[model samples]
Target: MTALVEVVRSGFVESVHHGSLVVTTPDGAVRASIGDVHSPVYPRSSNKPLQALAMLRSGLEVADDDLALVCASHNGEPDHVERALALLERAGLTEDDLHCPPDRPRHEPAAEPRRAAMNCSGKHAGMLATCVAAGWPTADYTDPGHPLQRAIADTVSEMIGEPIAWTGVDGCGAPLLAYSLTGLARAFGRLAAGTGTPRRIADAMRAHPWLVAGTGREDTVLMEAVPGLLMKGGAEGVHAFALSDGTAVAFKIADGNARAREPILVETLRLLGETPKDEAREAVDRMAVGAGVVTGAGRDVGSLRVTGAVAEALGTGS
Candidate 1:
C-alpha cells in the first residue's frame, strides 16, 4: 500500500491513510497506478452499475429514472424508499421480497426502520424485477446459486475480463464478486465509452444522479458537478468512475477510512484534467474541501489533505 492522504491537526500530521489506485486510458490500458491495483478486492457497491447492466441483459426493463435507482446505493430518504417500493410493485412484489436487512435512512434519523428504507433496497428490488422478467425465482434472488445471481456473476466476470477471485455475501445479502481495481476500472471504461447495454446503464446514472445516491451525497454531488462523469462509491473505501471520454479510475483505501476518499478522488480528478463547471463550482468546491477541518475548542485548527503519492501525482506534495 501507498500513503494516499493525511490528517493534519494544529498543523501537525496526526494520521495517514494508505490505498491502491489505478487510472486507465480510454482503451483500458493502465495509465498510472499506486500500490497493488492488480490484486483482487471486494468492490462493495461500486459494482452496482455493472450489476444493473447485467439485470438489463437478463431482460429487466424499467424507466430511465428507475434504472438509475436500480444501480443505487441510496440515502434511504423518502423519495428513495418510495421509488424502490414502486419498482417492487411494478414487478408484482413487495418489500417483503427484499432480502436486504431492514434499516432506516442514513441521512434522516426520524424515519422508521423498514426493509424498503435500507440503502440496498433499490438493488434488491432490481434483482427481484429481473427475476420476474427472466422467469427466475424471486424468493431466492439473493442466493448465490440463484439464476439471477449466477447471471450477475457471469456478466461481472465478462465485463471485467477475468474470473472472480472470490465470492462473498454483500451487506445487502447478495452475492459479492471480487476483482482487481484494474479490472473494475476497465469495466467502467467500457460503460463510459457509450456502447450498447452498458451505455444505457451509464446514461441512466448520469441522467439521474440524485436517484443514484441522494441529496448531499458524494456520488450525487460529484456526478451533478462534473459533466459526463459516471461515478460510484462503495463501502470499505472503494470508489470508481469513468469520464465520457472513457478514461477510468478505481481505488480502495487500505485502512477503509471513508474520510480519506474524497480528498484523494478530488486530487486524482484534477490530475486527470477535470475542471468543475461554473454553475456547480460551489458544490464541487465543498466536496473538494474534503475531510474538512480539525478544530480545537470549536475553532478551526488544521485540516485533512491529500498527501504522499496522491499528493505528488496532483503536484501538491507535502
Candidate 2:
C-alpha cells in the first residue's frame, strides 16, 4: 500500500493517508502509478464533465457558460445560484423540478440553503434541460432506467473504455458510476484533448473559472494560473486534472481528507515534468499541510507532510 501523506506533530509521525495515483500520457501509456490503480472507486463530482457530455449528446442546447455550470459543483455564490435558476427557467422548469436535496451553500461567509444553493443544482438543471430537449418525462429523471441516465451511462462507458463496474446514487440523488483510477486518468486525458462536448465544456470552465467552483477555490485558482490545464475535485478525496500537453493525473486519498489533495497533485505534476506557475504554486501550498501552518490552541505546531512510497514516486525527500 502507498501512504500518500503523513501528519506530523512535534517532529513525530502522527497519522498517514494511503491512496492510489495514476498518470498517463496522451497515447495511453502508463507514465506512473503509486498504488493499486486498477481498483474501482467512485469518482463523485469529478465525473460531472463527462456527464455534461451526455446532456450535449442528447441534444440539450445552452450557451458555453451554461454548459460549464452544468459541469460544476459550484460553491453556490450569487452567480452560481442565478445561473442555476436561469437554466431551470430556460427549460420551462423551476427549482421544484430539481430532485437534488437542497444544501447550505459551500461558499465562505456561509448562507442559508436554497434549491439554487445546492452544489448539484447545476447538474440537476442540466439533466432537466436534457429531458426537456429530448421530450423525456421530467419526473423520475434520476432513475437509472431513465433514457437520459442510460445515455449518460453509455457515455461514461465509452470514456472509461470499460463497462460499468458499479452504480450508486450520489449525494444529489443522481446516479454515480465507478471506474479504476487509471481509467479515470485516461478519461481526463481525452477531456483535455477535447473532441466535441469536452472541448466546449473545457473552454467554458477555463473562461469562467469562478462558476466551476468559486473565488479562491483550488480548482478556480489553479485553472486561472495555468492556462489550458483543466481540473476537478470530487467528494471523498478524488481529484483529477489534465494538461494541454496531454498529461493527466487522477488519484484518491484513502482516508478521504481533502487537505492532502493539492500536495499530491502538485508533486504529481512535478513528476510529470510540469511545474505550476507561481500563483498556482502558492494556492497549492495553501492547500498543502507541511507547506502550510498547523495550529493548535491558536498557536503554531508541527505540520503534515508526504511520506512512504509516494515520496519516492514524486522524487521528493521523505
lDDT of 2 by residue, 1-318 (tens): 788887777777777888988888886667778988887899999999889989999999999888889988888888999999999998999998999987778755456667788888999999999999999999999999999999999998898777789999998999999989888888888888867777777778778877889876778877887778888899999999998866788999988888778767666655556666775676666565544456677765777676646657655644
Q: Write the per-residue lDDT of candidate 1 for residues 1-318, one digit (tens) a residue.
A: 688878888778998889999988898898888899998999999999999999999999999999999999998988999999999999999998899999989886777789998888999999999999999888888888998888899999998888999999999899999999999999999999868899999999999999999988888888887899999999999999999999999999998888878877777788777887788777666566553456788776776677658656434554
Highest-scoring model, lDDT: 1
Candidate 1: C-alpha RMSD after superposition: 1.7
List candidate 2 segments past 4 Å from native: 108-110, 279-281, 290-293, 314-318
How many steric clashes does model 1 contain?
Answer: 0
